[model samples]
Target: MKAIVCHELNGPAALRLEDIPEPSPAAGQVRLRVRACGVNFADSLITRGQYQVQPEPPFSPGFEVAGDVLELGEGVTEFAVGDRVIALTLHGGYAEQAVVNVNRCVAIPPAMPYQHGAAFPVVFGTSHIALWHRARLQAGETLVVHGASGGVGLTAVAIGKQLGATVIATASSPEKLDIARQHGADHLINTSHDDIRLRIKELTEERGADVIYDPVGGELFNASLRAIAFEGRILVIGFAGGTVPQIPANHLLVKNVDVIGLNWPAYAERHPTVMTESFRILLDWYLAGAIQPYVSEIYPLEEAVDALHQVVSRKSTGKVVITVGD
Candidate 1:
């Protein structure tokens, strides 16, 4: 097998594509002949040893993948060998084969392409759980999404609309804003040239947004504090903006807003049934054409580092993936 091996926490630049022995599944796990892998911002963080669960060294750093089942370990009976599936792995998705727990693997539709299947799980799951379970976003309410052109952010915009919220998307450029609109953003605010607070206030008729889905925190979170409606909920998805925002407790009290910190990995463990339900709903939506997974670019397995660069540099909208085989 071939993998992008990281022996040190020196970031994506230090990642190297090297030939390595294939891994077999342990108990309750399945080995996948990986066809495509989703590249995430967390991959970059893991390379720098800044993410939550750091593996010791000389490991690949990919989370979501789509592949064919090669073998199933003990107690794994839900899927047969050669099942085309999407899975969420803790790591090791950057290789030609990855081992994931049986619970994390979901069968993909025969019609869905491997690239789209690879891109689906993490980003869509994050948004679905954040909006529905954590924030309890209501229909006919106003929803604001920051960094709306990025991976999970774009999913947030689309899911918000599907859930009957009036979606307001904010991005740094007109091109990005256009992409947001195409994904169902009812209103667009250019963060670079336009004022987010003022535009959101104007668009919402001064009521402010009912739910703010934010993956890029920092200054955008500060703006959300000011722009949120009374009793609004701000779901902190990530700190992709580079600076982590320190939430002011007083601000939450003033408007009775809830600043909810959403970490899906923990949620998935605590409520495995709910996570499975969420995936079921999302997969149905995908099959029904109610949601679309966007892949901005796809690189071969060896260029996995470049895919990570595209995510970290904010050059790619939606998802960037790595194709593991010919």
Candidate 2:
């Protein structure tokens, strides 16, 4: 099997394509003939040993994959061979074959393409759980999504609108803002030049946003703190901006603001029921055509490094997928 292997804790540039031995399924796991893999910003972080669950050196960085099941591990009866599924591998997805725990795998909808299946899990799941389960976003509330054009941010915009909240999207450029608008954002903020705090104040008649979904931390998170409603809930998705902002407890006390940190993958280990229910609802919405992944680019497995670079550099919109087998 061909795989992109990282021998040391460098960045994406250090990842190299090489022929590696095929992986086999263990008990409670299944071997997949990987068709496609989702390239996430976390893929870049894991390469540099910055992710939450860092595998040792000489590991692949892909987290989510979609493919056909070649064999089911012992004690796995939920799925049979040849079932099409999308799985959260945590790592080892940047290869022609991968072994993933059956618990982390969800059967892909029949109508969904391999690429869509690969792109769906991480971003959509993160945003859905963050807004619906964690934040408890309500209809008629004002929701703001920072980095609204990126992978997870785009999903937050769609989910916020689907939940009936008026969405205000913030991105670094007009082009990115336009993409967010097409995905159902009610208002747009060009963070490259606009005053985010003042804009939210103006847009909401000074009431501020009811929920702020921030995947880009740094200064944008600081702005969200000031622009939030009195009882607003802020969901901290990630620090894609490279700097994790320090939260001042005074701000939380004054406004009754709730800063919630979401580790989406934790659900798989600690709260499996929540993950299962979330996936059921998400798959239902997908079949109803209510939400769809916006895959901006697809790269061959040989160019997986370039794919990771595209996401790490924040140059691509929506999801970037790496197709494995033809």
Candidate 3:
């Protein structure tokens, strides 16, 4: 199997492609002939040794994949060989074949393509957990999503609208804002050209947004607090803006707002049943054509470095994937 191996602590450009031995499933894992691998911002961080869960040097850097099961590990009865599946592997998905825990794998919808299934788990899971569970977003309420053109951002926008919220999407460019509009965002705000706080307030008649889905923390996170409504819930999804913002307690206290932190991986580990149920709902929406996992570009497995670089550059309108095999 050929995999993208990171032997040193460098960025995506330092990732190397080389032939590696295929992995076999353990007692609770299954081996997959990887069809596509999803590249994420975490993949870029892991390659640069900046992510929280850093595997040692000389490890593959992919978090999610979709493929056909090659062989089932012992004690695995829910899946079988040749079944198309998507799994949330911690790493080692940017290759021809990989091993993943059975619990982390879910049967992809029959109508979904391999590329979408590969891209679904992380972003969709995050959006579902953040909006439905953490924030408890309500129907007819106004929701604002920052970085609304990125993978998880777009998912949040779509899910917000699906759940009956008047979705307001924010991006830095008009093109990116257009992407969010096409994905069901009821309103769009280009942060570069307009004042997010002013626009959000203007759109909602100064009541502010009922829920703010902020994955790109930093200055933007701080400003979002100003646009939050009374009793508003701000879901903190990530720190993609290169800086993590510090929360001032006074702001929350004055507005009677809540800042909810959404740690998707930790939540999945701590609440297995909830994770499974969340994915099931996402799959249900996907099968009904209620949601679509957008893949802006697909690169071959050997081009994993370029794929990660694209994601790191923050230029992708949707998810970027690696085509591992047929």
lDDT of each: 0.93, 0.95, 0.90
Candidate 2 lDDT by residue in tens digits, 97-126 = 999999999999899999999999999999
Measured against the true structure, the TM-scores of the candidates, in listed sequence, are: 0.99, 0.99, 0.98
Look at candidate 3 and tell me the lDDT of residue 225: 95
lDDT of 3 by residue, 17-70 (tens): 899888988898999999999989999888888877789889998999999999
Greater-TM-score candidate between 2 and 3? 2
- Clash count, candidate 1: 0
Residue-level error in angstroms, candidate 2, position 93:
0.5
Full ranking by TM-score: 2, 1, 3
- Candidate 2: residue pairs that collide: none
Candidate ordering by lDDT (highest first): 2, 1, 3
lDDT of 1 by residue, 1-326 (tens): 89999999989999999999989899999999999999999999999999898898989999999999999999999999999999999899999999999988999999899999999999999999999899998899999999999999999999999999999999999999999999999999999988889999999999999999988888999999999999999999999999999888999899999989877977557789889999989989999999989999999997888889999999899999999887
